[model samples]
Target: MQIVDHGRVSVGCHVANGWTVVEATGEMDIFTSPMIRAAIIKLLQDGHRHFVLDLCPTAFLDSMGLGMIVAITKRIQAHQGSLRIACADQRLLHIFSLGGLRKSYAFHDSVDEATREVPRHNGLGRWPRPRD
Candidate 1:
């Protein structure tokens, strides 16, 4: 795993069980959103289909940060990719829930668990899944 520490956040990435786990640490607000977005975009361009965003250490997440996640989700879906999110902070989880995003993607308890469940790719956004 290669870890790069930036001014406001430290980003780390590694491949685990065929899934790319990107660990982001620190406040994820307007100031630091671009850095994270660039990293994810690069990963996607590099042909990584499955992704896990480990936001366990995110101290704060503003609208820009949420936008980044939303944009990435769209990009991944367009490429027929999948996404998993691992966030430890209950407060931050509540923010996602409030935005009606809690059920849009799979939320895992840990990054390790997310990597193991990379094959589970539910449809993106609020689109209804076809009844089986």
Candidate 2:
């Protein structure tokens, strides 16, 4: 497992059941969102296609953090990958709802629940078009 700590926040990642689980501890704000983004980007570069973002331990989140997740989601989708978010915190859940992102992501109550099923894809791998 690799972890990056920056005083206010700490990020860690590990592979589980064919999925990469990235967990964040502490507040995810302007000061710490980068660590989460960097970790996921590195994992994607490392050939990971499926991911479970375990934000259960996160105590706080800000607009920048939400934006970072949105950007990361787009990047992962563009790469033909999948991302599931595990968050059981009511406050955070309310924030997501208020941000109008509740329907945009697949959210679960726990990491185990999130990793139990494979995300549905369009039957295309990394490349959408076939070679001629």
Candidate 3:
């Protein structure tokens, strides 16, 4: 179901199998990160752990946007939860690599694959993340 709709981005949540898929469409920058951040935090507070971030429709992700994602990931890790990102956009994938975050997080080709009961992950979790 759709959760929040802001000018720059829209956040939606759906149950796929046993996991929750949180889809974000449109640009996610400084202007929209706060809203997304709040929504994710609320989900966390509500005991939603594992997440599938369907960023297929997300067109842009600035520094603030990337930072928000990293922050949320840290929080999820703190809770022993996992996050899978589904971003087919080549630009975003390239940005993830350029930002030195490719190994820090897991990326899937589609949301369907990402929202599986178990998210794929490597044993090592020592990658550097964006600073707060």
Candidate 4:
């Protein structure tokens, strides 16, 4: 996936198996909130409720970005889906923890772990059969 720029923020998306991975870079303040929101919403609309937000490359994150994530989580939960966040940045991690988001969202140390752990659902309401 190529990096998509919305002003100073860069967002990239890719799909592996049934997980939709979104890698975000640059500042994530109010100015870049719309881009992030749009990317997430688009994925959900495309029938991709399982998400792995790779934020290791993200340089900054503000309240707007945090709110967007929380909103996405709510939407995913409504659909019986899940959202995992991969963030190795200390600053970002601290912010999430301090904001109480860590308790609400699943945080992973790596993108691989996030993607591997997200549950895959079969439209029939049961989890997809595990792979061998």
- Give the winner by lDDT: 2
Candidate 3, 4-80: lDDT as tens digits: 89787899997776566888999889899989989988988998777888999898998888889888888777766
- Candidate 3 regions exceeding 4 Å error are 117-132
**Tens digit of lDDT per residue, candidate 2, span 33-63?**
8888988888888888788889999999988
lDDT of 4 by residue, 7-82 (tens): 6888999986578789888888888877788878877787877778889888999888888877766677667676
Q: Using alpha carbons, what is the TM-score of model 3?
A: 0.87
**What are the TM-scores, per candidate, against the unseen true structure?**
0.86, 0.88, 0.87, 0.83
TM-score of 2: 0.88
Please provide, for model 1 over 1-132, each residue's C-alpha lDDT reduced to its tens digit, 9 standing for 90 to 100. 645578788888988987888988898888888888888888889888778889887888877888889888888777777778898789988888787676666788898878774454534533323223
Measured by TM-score, the strongest candidate is: 2
Clash pairs (backbone) in predicted model 4: none
When summed lDDT is taken over every stretch of 10 residues in candidate 4, the lowest stretch is: 123-132
Measured on C-alpha atoms, candidate 3 has an lDDT of 0.79
lDDT ranking from best candidate downward: 2, 3, 1, 4
C-alpha lDDT score of every prediction, in listed order? 0.79, 0.81, 0.79, 0.75
Report the error of model 1 at residue 11, Å: 1.1
Candidate 1 — which residues are off by over 4 angstroms?
118-132
